[model samples]
Structures are given as C-alpha cells and as structure tokens.
Target: MYDLIIIGAGASGLISAIVASSSGEKVLLIEKMSQAGRKLRITGKGRCNLTNTLPLKEFLKHCGSEPRFLYPAFNLFFSKELINFFEQLGLKTVEERGGRIFPQSGKAQDVFLALINEIEDSSCQVLKDTQVTSLMIENNRIVGVKAQSRTKGNKEYLAKKVILAAGGESYPLTGSQGDGIRLAKAAGHNIIPTLPSLVGLKLKDYNQERIHPSIVGFGVRNVKATISLESGKKIAEEFGELTFRENGVEGPIIITLSRQIARLLSQGERLFLNIDFKTALSEQELDEKLLSELNIRGKEDLRSVLRAFLPHELIYLAIYQTALDPRKKASFVTSQERKEILAFLKHCQFEIIGDFGYEQAIVTQGGVDLKEINPKTLESKLIKGLHFAGEVMDLDADTGGFNLQIAFSTGYLAAQNAEKED
Candidate 1:
C-alpha cells in the first residue's frame, strides 16, 4: 500500500511525486511511457519554457476559460515560487523575451534530468511503461488503481490517495493520448469537449494558388490578423509575427487565436482570416508611401518596386491580388491599381477551413471541467482522495510558459493536500 499513487509522470505528476515524497508520504509515480517527462523534454522546441515572470494579474489573462479557478493554486505557488523552487533544485533559470523563463543551461534535457534525478533520490517508487487502466473506487470513496505493465501484467495498487496528473490529449507521440480524460470521465467528472489549440489554421487553398509556389514558408513579421466567422461576426484580432504554411497560417498570434477558433469551428462556424501585411501604416498612409515609391523608382518594374514592400515570393500574391502586370513600369501603374494594392495589403483575407489538428497543436484546449475540482487542493469534489492536476483539468494557457506553470502549481497543491501525517 502506498500513501499516494500519481498517474502520468509528466510535469504535474512529477511535481506531485516530489512534493508528496518530500512531505514524507509513500509515493508511487506511474508512467505509461517508457521514459518519463517525454513531453517536458520536447517543450519549447527542446528549450523547456518553464514559467513567465509576469505579475499574477497580467499572467492570468493569458490563460484560457476560467482564470479565476487558478487563483487558489497560483496564490500558493506562482512564478516567483516556481523560480525559487527550481533554483533550490539546483537548476538555474533565465528570463527571456516576453518574460518567458527557461533553464540557464539552454537545454530541456537538463531540466528533465534535474527533475527525474530528484525523483530517483526520493523514497517514491517509480514505475515506467506501466499503464494505469482505471480507478478502484468503492462506494463513492477513493481506494486504489487497476493497472497493467508488460513485465508485471495486470495488478491492483491500493493507495490512501491518488493524483491524476496525466496531462491532456496533445502530442500523442509523447504519450499524452487523453488517458487522463477517460479516467476522469469514468470517475463521473464532466469533461469540456476537447479541441486542438495553439496550432495552425488551414486557410482556403485558393490563397495558395494565387501565390507563387516559393511562398509556402514565407514569413510576414509584425502584422495584424483579424479572425471572423462567415456570418461576419468578428471573433478576435491580434498583432504578431506569422509564417505562411503550405495550407494555412502558423505562429505566435495564429496559434493563440486557433484555440478559440477551434471551439467555434467545432460548433459549425465557418471562419475567415484577414491579415494586415502593413500594420504599421494605415491605408491612406500606405497609399502615400506607395505613390512615393513609384515616383522615385518610375522606371523599375512594378514587381521590382513591390520588393521594397514585400518578400520576393509574396510580391507575386500582391501582384495577383492587385491585378497589376509585373512587366509594367512603376510609372505606368494606374491609380486603380494603386487602390487595389492598398486594399490587398491592408486586408488580405482567406477562408479558414480548419486547423492542423491535435498532432500539430502545442496544447489541448479543454479537458475535465474545473468546477468539479477543489480550487485550493485540486481534489475532485466528486470523489474523495482523488485529485486532478495539469492539462487534465480543463486548464490551458497561451504560449510563454503559462501552461507549465499551471501544471506545477496544481501538482504542488494536490500533493500538499494529499499528504497525511506519518
């Protein structure tokens, strides 16, 4: 018998094990993957974005759905505490652009190494390649878990408490395949319909056909993007760098907006993406600049002059949209052509068919609802001795380390409450 059985050895599960074991609780950390923290190692493109240095209020705004639900846990373990905790663990960290925090070593492997090494030193029993099938609840009270492993086959492990920190259903290659959501649902927890977020949105293929073949990976920096449904209802607008994908768009702003758009799309909403290629200038201002460029370079080919405004490949799309002849001299360009160019630059629109889906999504948008879990302890209100943590709890935040912070904070809270006096 163990004091606590923590399912899924990802960020939350690992943190739960550390906190519980350090509190002198007998712990058994189970992971279905052959290696623990597989997702952690590949996060932030292998740099391991830990947490942001943003103030609590500002930070909460980046989180999805109910930000209020995190108040209790963040109050207990916010970014400052996270930094100090990692520091105490002998992993030095650095704050980068946008207050994003990462290990000073600049290697995600180092962070994972530090965490798993700390786990190995603790009295907690580690079980890798072990699949936890279901909870062994009796009479509405918590008991143990039924699990199976290739070496041990099927077995039941009884525990005084259990922490479901199995993460969300994103990056299935890393072992986050919605096992936790299924377990939560089986235990009678309400699940918010899951969707892929922080992924690429598939734009209408017509936009690609208009552009040159070389434009597939073209990047447009510092642009404003507006999202709206086919009904002409505006969904959102944001400004950030974006890269043109073969099928659609991806980048910081696009990925962030993809969360809400995905949910809206699942409800049968058709959408459109409009990018302001020249966000720094208004339509009038851009017109003046375009005319000024034409006056100075009158003999240059219209396409050649456009190179000053856009990338070599993007110029083809601009020319196509503006209906301007590439061979035409800047001096020969008509006023109507200039007007078309202005509109195209300011309002480049594309139909949003769908997103790149879960495999490409950086995080899962929804999971087990938060109303069913205790805000302070992360314990499931429906079942005693059953706690929830991390992405499994219908909580996910934008990029820049917010989601990982949620995992760590909730894991700490769950472990803190689950521990019993020896």
Candidate 2:
C-alpha cells in the first residue's frame, strides 16, 4: 500500500506529492486528464505566476475572508519557501509588478515540467487518465479511492492516506469540473455555495460595436472603483486598472470586485459601479483644472477639449449620454453642464447585471468551509486520513499571485502534517 495518495495533479497536488515523497513517503498522484497541470499551463497567459514576494502578513491581507485561518499554512510555507523550492528544482524566478513572481524563462510549461520532474525524481507514481469515482472509507476514516483508469476500464487503488487537491469549478476545459466538490460532499464535508471570483461583469447594454470601440481593450489606470449595492451601501472598493469589455468591465480592479458583486446579486441586489477615473485628483483639483482648460481654449468645443483628460471614446460617450452637442464651444457650456461632466468623469457608473460565470473566473469564491478542516493539518475534522488542499478549500485571495500562494502553502502544510502523522 502507498503511504499517501494525492488526487488531482494541478499545482497543489504536484507540490503536495513532491513534499510528501521527499519526506520518504511512497506517494501516488492521480489525474483525470491525460497530462498534468493543464490549468497551470494556461495561468498568467502561459507565464505561470508562481507566487508573490510580499510579506506573509501582507499576503494574508489579500484574502478577503478568514485571514487568521491561513496563519498556520503561511507560517509554515511562505512565499520565500516557495521561491526556494522552485529554485532547488532549477526553475529560477523573477519578481514583477505587485510582487508577482514568474519564471525567468517566462514559460508556464517550464514551471509545470519542473514540478513534474521533481515529482518523478522523488520516485512518486503518477497515474494519468484516471478518474476517481468514489472514496473508500472505513470507520470514519478514508481507506483509499476507487477510480477508473482510461487504459484499464474499471480498476481501483487503495492507499493509507488521500489528499484531495482537485481544483474548484472554474475553467472546466482545464479539468477543474467540480469533481472534488462532489467527492467532498460524498465524504460528508460541508460544501459552501460556490461562485465565480475574479471574473468579468456582464452589463445590460448590448450596443456591442459602440461599447467595444469606446471601452473594450482600453484600461483606466490608477482608478478607484466602488460597487454601490441596491441598499445604497458600498460593498467593495479597489484601485487599479479597469478594462472595459465588450459587455462590461474587467481587469484586476473589476475582477476583485466581481466576487462581492456576485454574492450581492445572489441576494437579489442590483449593482452600480462608480469609477473615479482621476482618483488622485480631488473634486476641487479637477474643477480648477477644468476651469483652466476651458478658459485657455474658450473657442474650442467642450467635447473636443475634454479629450485631453479622458479617452476620446469616453468623451464621446459622455457627450451622447448628457445629450450635449460635441461641437458646442467651451464658453457656451453652463456650470450645470460642467458639473455633469465632472460627475461623469468622477462617478462613471455601470449597471452590473451579473458575472461572466466560471468560465472566465480566476478562482472560485466559496468551497469546502474552513471550519470543518483543521487549519494546522488541513485534514477534515469529521474524517481521518482524508485531507484537502488548494482551491478545494474555502480559502481564496485576490489577484497578484496570492491565490497560487495559498494553494502552495496549504498543500505543503497538508502533506507535511500527513507525513508526520504517518
């Protein structure tokens, strides 16, 4: 019998298998796909953001909820440890903006291949094209897993311990098809309501060509975006790039707000996002600047003059929405019109009808509740020898490589504790 069996060969599974095997445990890693790290290969547009170089406390802050829940994992295997681990595997890393660490080679495949090579060198057995059908439990403890191999139709393997690192239900094409959630539910673990996090927002307006030309691919930098809930309470506030999509808003800023927006939407609340395009400029500063520009170019059209401060598409959109003639001179613009212009620039609003769904989400917001798992060991409180790691757990963070760090940290903690217990 193997010492440890890891289900799913994604980032977390790969790390856990490597750690467990290096500790002298006979580890068996199973994957449903023909190859491993399908999702990892596509992350960061193939660059594979491994982890962030931020401090442990700062990294935990990116996690929206249950910051304390990650204390044990972060303390055990932080980002520095991860960098060291990759370096030991011959994969050099580089830090980019926001402390995001990517491979020096700039290839996600290199990262995956490096991890796979380490797993192989450690004498770990990797079984591909194998789909786990069910968990084999005895006396409230997991005994082994029953899976069907593509080569040998209905066969099963038994092990002493099992780690469920199967990813959350996002990017199904990458093999994250909610199978782990199904397994957790079968094993009597509480599965939290899952929603798409770090996904784009879908708007009501279908004026595709107009929206695409004006907003799509255009990123508003250093902007503060606030999601105004139906109750008039603002839920989330973020400052970053706001990428306008053909349907709605996207990019790091919008994706960060998408989780809260999606949760509010589930409660029958409609969303309205306000974008402060000039977040660095106060109202007084913006007003004064506008007055100066208007005074200097009194004969110039207000719409044409505002293009210096905003994108041409945005200026045109503002003019169209305010029903102002683009050809009107700045001198003819009334104070009320200027106020409207300021409001549009400061509070660029968009009605968020819904999220873009899991297909585009970077992570699943909710998963197996954390309370049911021992944070130190990452093992289920209700089950023995059955552990969880990575996105399958409730822990998730905002963008900038924090989520991947969570996966690596928790996976290491789980494998380490499991090996110790063995």
Predicted structure with the largest lDDT when compared to the true one: 1
In order, what is each prediction's RMSD in angstroms? Answer: 1.8, 2.1
Query: For model 2, what is the C-alpha lDDT against the true structure?
Result: 0.86
Candidate 2 lDDT, 1-422, residue by residue in tens: 88899999999999999999998998999999999999999888889898998887788788858889889988999999999999999999999988999999999999999999988888899999999989999999988999998588977678889999999999988889899989999999898888888899886653447543655677778999998876768888998887777777799888888866667776768888888988878998998888888888899998767986887767755765566777889988888988888887788777788888888989987889889999889998988999999999886788788888888888899899879999
> Count of backbone clashes for each model?
0, 0
Instruction: Please identify model 1 stretches exceeding 4 Å from their true place.
Output: 206-210, 231-233, 295-299, 320-324, 420-422
- Candidate 1 has an lDDT of 0.89
lDDT of 2 at 223: 92
C-alpha lDDT (0 to 100) for residue 19 of candidate 1: 93
What are the lDDT scores of the predictions, listed in order? Answer: 0.89, 0.86
lDDT per residue, candidate 1, 91-209, as tens digits? 99999999999999999888888888899999999999999999989888679999999999999999989999998989999999999999999999999999888999997755676
User: Which regions of candidate 2 deviate over 4 angstroms?
Assistant: 212-214, 291-299
